[model samples]
Target: YKLIIHTDTLIGLSFSGVHTWLEMYGCEWDDQTGAADAFDQFGYDGEDFVSLDLKELRWISPVQQGIPTVQKWNNDRAYLESDKNYFSTECIEWLQKYVQYGKSSLKKTVSPQVSLLQKSSSSPVTCHATGFYPSGVTISWQKNGQEHHEDVDLGELLPNEDGTFQKTSTITVTLDEWKKNKFSCVVEHQGKTKTENEIRTNPEGSVPIGIIVGALAAVVLLVIIGVAGYMVYQKKKGFKPVSGSDDGSNSSAHTVPQA
Candidate 1:
């Protein structure tokens, strides 16, 4: 029988003029034999700066700029030894408690809100899913219950201020396709519940409400202009109407004479 033991820690720091923002320490051992197989120190100094491979007794990614820092760290063995001592004595216990709290808190789930919208006839339909926990979520486009890949644009998962993740998937469809069938956006997350939004087809030859209203207004304006023009044309042709009786009595109706 074989068993293995592994421990690692990651720490991040931000300071003025400090390019080294992140660091990690990793060590692995064989449990049954009680012998370590690997111990490593890796860091990022504006990039992957350097790594100490204790198993090989060598350094990896020894950039010219980082060589001096590596040499200085290696020569000051006492400080490195002190760091390891602190991690084993004080950090491990606190890390374990934090891990336990994470596991318990993650058991609670939040459902995502799915929205399906289209910007215009020329644009694709956007499937936006937001406010979900545990970032490992799948958002996809489905056409009539089957997975669709063609003409689909997938967006990156972005973190929100509330610690939740949001993603969007868009699918290009012509006006005919949008009016002929239905499409859906499906979201699958860690929780048992799944959320989806269905976009139903619009009626054939249907236009947006704004466009419809504008067309009607145009027609009404044209009709008004045509009637006004006809009245002006009749007056220009020298057609005259008989005046009404001055008293409040019905007068004989008289038609304008033809020009």
Candidate 2:
């Protein structure tokens, strides 16, 4: 069954006029129950503009601004019938193929490699989790063995080129703060947690030069994203591509063991 809520004033629907957007229609099917669902939704600037009512097999407009186009689409008998047939049959076939193609990789889970990174002495310390499968992980910081939240920055879940995923959480702390308290990074993935002391005092008075220059581009990027948010694409509960993440070529990477 299709889910549609109708009210006179477009109650919860948000509309935007500044940007233009259009979402391709979506279709879903259940293999075991032989059930099917379909939707043709259009959005403009993140606003729900219009959608097709599969139950009535007609186009319905949530807001008044979309009415004119809705009227035109609802009047097109051939277009309506063609859409109905396509969603009921063609879409399901493609969805099934997609399920078969990615099922093995999508169901597999690989443990992540966790590390703490700092571009320079003054840069924010980052806890990085990479080479994990299925794209879900939790990266957090702890001070004195307790959860620490202030001045923490959570990064976007990004894809890697090797079919795994990577993520990072960064924290800004002063040299005095580090000297006064113990700081650690905790990464939880697939029911296991890895906790490691993120800051180390190099008695040699120097860190690998490559480590400082390693991922310089990424460090600059983190500063930009810390100030301005990054773009994220919303994928429905279906198949999507995941390219491997580029874990930089820093030879002195300190990795924590999985528990």
RMSD of 1: 33.2
Candidate 1: the clashing residue pairs are none
Q: For residues 1-259, write the lDDT of model 1, one tens digit per residue.
A: 1111222233445665444434444334333564543333444554666665543344455567667766666665565554454334333333444455777878757777777756656667777777777778787777777888899998777655555667778888897986776677778877454545555344455533433444455566679789987876555322121224235343222111111
Candidate maximizing lDDT:
2
Over 1-259, each residue of candidate 2 has an lDDT whose tens digit, in order, gives 2222111121233474345545456577777787998877777556888888987998887889888888887778887887777677655655665676678667798998887777667777778777787778989888998999999999877656555677778899997897799999999988988887755433344543323343454566577676553232222222221222224222121111110
Which 10 successive residues of model 2 have the least lDDT summed?
250-259
CA RMSD per model (angstroms): 33.2, 15.0
Kindly report which residue stretches of model 2 are placed more than 4 angstroms away from their true locations once superposed. Answer: 1-29, 34-95, 198-259
How much does candidate 2 score in TM-score? 0.44
Q: Count the backbone clashes (under 3 Å) in each candidate.
A: 0, 7
User: lDDT at 224 for candidate 1?
Assistant: 78
